[model samples]
Target chain A: MNIKEYIDTANKKALERMASVQPILIDIELEAKNIIPGMDNKTILHAGPPIEWERMCGPTQGAIAGILVYEGLAADLTEGYEIAASGEIKFDCNHDHDTVGPMTGITSPHQPVFVLEDELTGKKAYCTLNEGRGRVLRFGGWNKEVLDRLNWMKSVLAPTLKKAIKHSDGINIKTIIAESLHMGDEGHNRNRSGSYLFLSELTPHMLDTTNNEIAKEVFLFIKKNADIFHLNLSMPHSKLIADAARDIDYCSLVVAMARNGTDIGIQVSSLGREWFTSPASIVEGLYFPGYSEKDACPDLGDSTISEVIGIGGFAMAASPAIVSFVGGSAREATLRTRRMYEISAGTSSIFTIPSLDFKGTPVGIDIRKVVELDETPLINTGIAHKEAGIGQIGAGLTAAPYDMFKDALKAFGAKYL
Target chain B: MKSNMNDLLSEGPKVINIGLRSFYEASETQGIKVVHIDWKPPAQGDIETIKLLDRLL
Candidate 1:
């Protein structure tokens, strides 16, 4: 296969297909196994590349143990840990099943997930709902309280949102994301404005779908948590968009970039489902009071899916307020987005930055350009405590290690050159 | 014969700094005009990797 014969047009098609897809929040599913292809009762899907239970990081192990207990496979987290260690639980990558998760990115078959779809291509992707900050499962928090929150989400929140979404004939996430860019949400780590926009779409329908008390309770559950309620929705929205561009012959743009706590992985458009990985990098940023760098885990999560299609960190110029949360100056945040264009193959005509004279956000991370340029994707993310149950300690900045891109380029060469 | 450096330095040393950012920062602190290029050793300064990259790029 001569890459020169096909690469340029192939990449252009990949970029076009990626940017053109409109991910709409079409449904809320009760079970991950029902919507996610290949997920099973005993299988626990995780973020980033596949790994055995022995090599799994602390946060991931904690999250998995909690989910096992939630699935009723174990009596408690302590027992859940032993079952997880015994290898009785099968593990799979979330990307393989068309799903993404945040932080430790644990997805049990019974957990609630948002299903986003592109009407034109009928492509769909799924992501589990976000449990609001502090002692949440995504950060490896598991106990009676944590299980109670998960249970409440399943019993009340999921059904309410499903009814509201169906009542509204599906919320247009593409529209909310476009508008939110102007209001300062990169659609990843900073989603305060997007949450309000998401609520604007859902609130009226939420009122119509449920009784007054339930509506108010669910409404405040989202309304009070301004930063994260929209994030789970954003992840699946980006996943749906990125899935459309995967497996295009000779296209070298990255389709997914996620960290499994132990390793950070990237899947290229031309490389099919094979992942190029590097040891997960330590995040650099401010820690919460009483906590320091020592408490933070390595970069972990499936949230980078938003960056894969260009909103998250790639659209940093549109969300300067993120500097305070992600720990950087406003200028640095803007520069990060400008720098991304150097490695990206294209820009999204829809997700434009107001600060940059309405210029489109850089999209399409090309693996060849990444190797040549030696610059990697800049990510803004939450930092989890290395110990399970400690939850999030801070939020910060990280980069995909360059070696992964080099390895991917060599693989591309071996196959195409 | 005239050198570009001579003319450049004659006007109080405007600088085009590459790789190391401290040099550009020092120049800027002195009110000198400076541009910093964020340069790095491509392919990690490995000749074999560069050779491979050359084939594909």
Candidate 2:
């Protein structure tokens, strides 16, 4: 087959797989060595593709130190630093272990993870719980307060959520995502609606499973942190969808987009696990009161999974409220979604936007279309501080570099057509 | 406006391009037929008239 014929056949198969996926939240489980295969005391799973400790960005290193402190392997920050540098702990990519996370994306051995399974394909994916917002370990905050928060999440929150999830017989994540889009959420930076939808489904179960006191506290915590509460659930949902559509021969669909503070990398379906990387670009948008562009780190997180599955930046038209943070107007949001359709293989059958006349969100990012149009995928991301321990500075928008797509196209041409 | 996307997409739809020829060129590359509308400011760059028209509209 010629190039176009090959791409047409591959894209048809990719779109079929993408459309067939049904990501359902199956259970909440403790992340023990037995649960996650190959997980052990020394294993530390960080986000994005693999990188050595010496080359790890500030936030990732800070998160590692924080994890050590949380696990009681280190007495203090200084000790934590020593332990990390001494190579006592192993660091690997979360993707390699069937897991995903938000910023910094650290998944220690004992952390609790949500188990998401695809009902159609029976493939599963996992993600750590969201640590709520500021001064959390995900952004590399390693203070006593951060460690205490993790302890509470691991002890109090995880067990409570586990009980609730059991009582609810596994909340349908796909339903929450679809409803959230209609109620004004793109399921990435702006998850207010998604969070509310999740609480609505989870609250009744929590009420039935737990006592009033603990239930009230859990409810209040989720209610207060509505913006990021849905992120943990959304990440694994995206991962399951991507996993279902992945590994098709000659398929140029991008299955993953991720960043460690130093580099942004993407994996294409046809190329299997090979990553095309470029230096992470600085984000441009509004910042917090005491921070500026100089304080912001490059884009970081596995949250880009949401974008790959076509809801985050690709469904911006559904969430106009995101503009206040991501530095664009409502018109621009709609335009961005419209433009994405040009480069995508097809529209999603599940997630639909009300503002777009109930049109399905664009899905299946075709690398051939990207290079042909010279348009890169836009990522809606949270900005972490350049230094560890500073937490989130702001949230904004940035595009994957054009060079990454160009390089992927060249590789695809050489390997396939 | 409730768009009948099916109608628009029935025969590999025609695009009504405005403001940029590059958009038309890009669409053409994807086998999308284009009909360019040569859009220009109504009052030929008259600031006062444009401001008045904005309020009137």
How far does residue A133 in candidate 2 sit from its true spot (Å)? 1.5
lDDT of 1 at A252: 84
Q: Write the per-residue lDDT of candidate 1 for residues A353-389, one digit (tens) a residue.
A: 9999999999999887788778899999999989888
Expressed as tens digits, the lDDT of each residue in A26-110 for candidate 2 is 7777764546667899888888878889998999999998888887788888788889999889888887778899999998888
Model 2 bad stretches (over 4 Å): B1-57
Candidate 2 chain A weakest ten by summed lDDT? A29-38
lDDT of every model, 2 decimals: 0.89, 0.84
lDDT of 2 at A365: 87
What CA root-mean-square deviation does each model show from the true structure? 2.2, 11.3
Q: Which ten residues in a row have the lowest lDDT in candidate 1 chain A?
A: A1-10
Clashes of each: 0, 0
Give the poorly placed runs of model 1, Cα more than 4 Å off: B1-13, B26-33
